[model samples]
Target: MDRATGTTDPGGGTRMTDRLLGVRRCLAAAPADLLLERLGTELARTYGTTETELLQVDYRLAALVPLSGAEPVIGAGTPAWRCFDHQSEVVQGGALHVPVTMRGDRLGVLRLAPVPDDPERRGELAEVATTLAHELVAVRPGTDRYAVGARTRRLTLAAEMQWELLPGRSRIRPSFSLAGQLEPAYAVRGDSFDWADDGQRVWLSTVNGMGEGVTASMLTCLGTNALRNARRAGLELADQASLADQAIYSYHQGIQHLSALLLELDLQTGVVTAVDAGSPRLLVLRGSEVIEQPLDDQFPLGMFDGTLYQSQRFELSVGDRLFVVSDGVPEAASQTARYGETALHRSVRRTRSMAPLEAVRSLLGDLRAFVGSDLVDDAVVVCLDWTGRV
Candidate 1:
């Protein structure tokens, strides 16, 4: 039987059509775990392969965790790492790997073995893997079992609270694309990101509150929601920042404060207005160089009861990329060295040619490799690419 086309799919129709129909039917009937297991088994039998596996990304361990609870999970140095790290299909040895991605976030990799050695054939197999991934993501939003399986250990109260409050892990729109990841994944605190586009303009923000544990996470959540509320009310950048600042100072008093950066991007003109409340800075990449964009200094939310926040505007040229990093990247320390701002600039230079989401994944992979251990602080990187296409 030809690998590309057998007599017929198991569903008694042409190979591609039957495979997709079968997947949709499974989606309508099976739960998350069962769906994954069934898909793996079906792929194995369909392709006459000896082994296949579905692994979800466990960012805490920086490892690929099996959804079926299998042993001997892999990550970092293998093809699974390359597939997700580069956000591209990878064919190496007898293994074929493809990233399970939706929006800008990389969910994990789909792995198969005993596949045809031809590069073109392997690419086709990777497409099948991606289709299966899309099917899984379609059903994943309404369930918690997928999230539960992705974790390697129990989550702390603060981590749980923060995770529940997230608008999403990543987002993609026509005018721009943004991606953010928080770590240690199962025990993060005082770090989060949010963004949305309202046809004409896009709103972006990142927050890192002072202190640790549940209280810190709660404060960040309040601060983030306050900004969202103000934005929804059609407040300008300065007013939105002020509302968040006033809410935190009045409600949490002098003890709690959060450093944040709020951005309003004009979709049509490629102009960006920012409200800087903390140490977070905006860096733009152009032609293999990372240039630091100056942002106005403002008081961190809750620092002063009546602080006035100012908005600083910058114009973006076509294809300019913006990076907003939590203090974690620059402050990170590896076994042999500390990851600093200069090194980060060099990294952006190295990865400048890749798409926004791919550059983000690559940079984060490097950070995890440098840190050696799970990050000690909640490191958040939000990347935005403005093509000025709108």
Candidate 2:
């Protein structure tokens, strides 16, 4: 309600209410590019400006992306420090200058040049800039909303590509069930889960590549494709591991490593076969007892050619559960503590009595509570249960 910065409207509540409603509409819309376009149009119209530009901060690249209606006067990939150093927004003659900021973060500066005769509209334009900044912060990206409009289009496209490669929410068969979830859903990278069934056997793999963003995503994509091809060819667990390792080595030249687990389940005998390579530990639950699978220090996938991997076999009883996960689950840490094996053991025990899908949901909930937030790394959980009735 600070009128000095135009936080409150001159006519009191009506204009402010309309602006809030507009923000709500923006939030409800699909396609971030469209939303940003709409926001830019509204800002230009409301401020009576010939042009309005939005700039966003890219933390990964340490640069700003410019959202401009005009071409090339100022563009994306501008240095953040230079903008701050210049205290950007002062125009030489007829141009208006305004900085778009939210909380203490400077999203980007807005440049609007008015016609020569309209000197009186500067305050109105400044007010609009302030309101827009607040609206950006309140809706998406929270404290960094100013950057949202600038990065929305490209990020949205990338998110769509990521979604296209992901598995369904749940994969159900006559004998078992599997499900997974990724944290910070819109920006997830470096976590992938895949499953293939050849009628005689079911093969499942979960992989977490090092680091994040496009590079990690590409590595995961390559490994996932290799896994599918190897399994479809009916390669034995060791052969499949070798093939996948060769593919990774050839593709990345030893630059990346994938913490992976490849599981094969026989539909006829209810036997679970697995190969664990530097992954987070897998948990097996029977009755009231929870046991960790013996990983035994195998090298991660893609590390070296001819690295031998051995498969471990377990008999699956009715109502028994298998929990496969990426490090994102067990390694999730709050400011003070890590969600270690002990916490995971207790969570799995508490949910041992639930249906496979419900148990997976409960386990993830418990993990989130332990971490105190969504995990920083990509987290994935694949739960398999043997429904004795099948």
Candidate closest to the true structure, highest TM-score: 1
Query: Which residue pairs show collisions in model 2?
Result: none
Give the per-residue Cα lDDT of candidate 1 at 86. 74
Tell me each candidate's TM-score: 0.81, 0.58
**lDDT values for all models:** 0.77, 0.64
> Candidate 2, which ten residues in sequence have the lowest lDDT sum?
69-78
**Native-to-model Cα distance after best TM-score fit, residue 17 in candidate 2, in Å:** 51
lDDT of 1: 0.77
Q: Tell me how far the alpha carbon of residue 207 in candidate 2 is from the true structure, in angstroms, after superposition.
A: 0.5
lDDT value for model 2: 0.64
Model 1: residues with Cα > 4 Å off, grouped in runs: 1-15, 40-52, 71-77, 91-96, 112-142, 333-339, 361-372
lDDT string, candidate 1, 278-351, tens digits: 75878998777789998877789998889998888889887888888888888899877889988899877776
- Residue 220 lDDT (model 2): 80
Tens-digit lDDT track of model 2 for 1-390: 444443565545434445545544554462433445565566555444565566554322223466553332333224333443243445545556665554323445556656324343454445455556555555543333334434433443334445446654455666666666555455778777787665667787888778668777777888888877888787898678778888998887778977788888887777888888877668888888998777656788889866778888887877778888777777888889889888888888897656554466677778777778655777777778767444
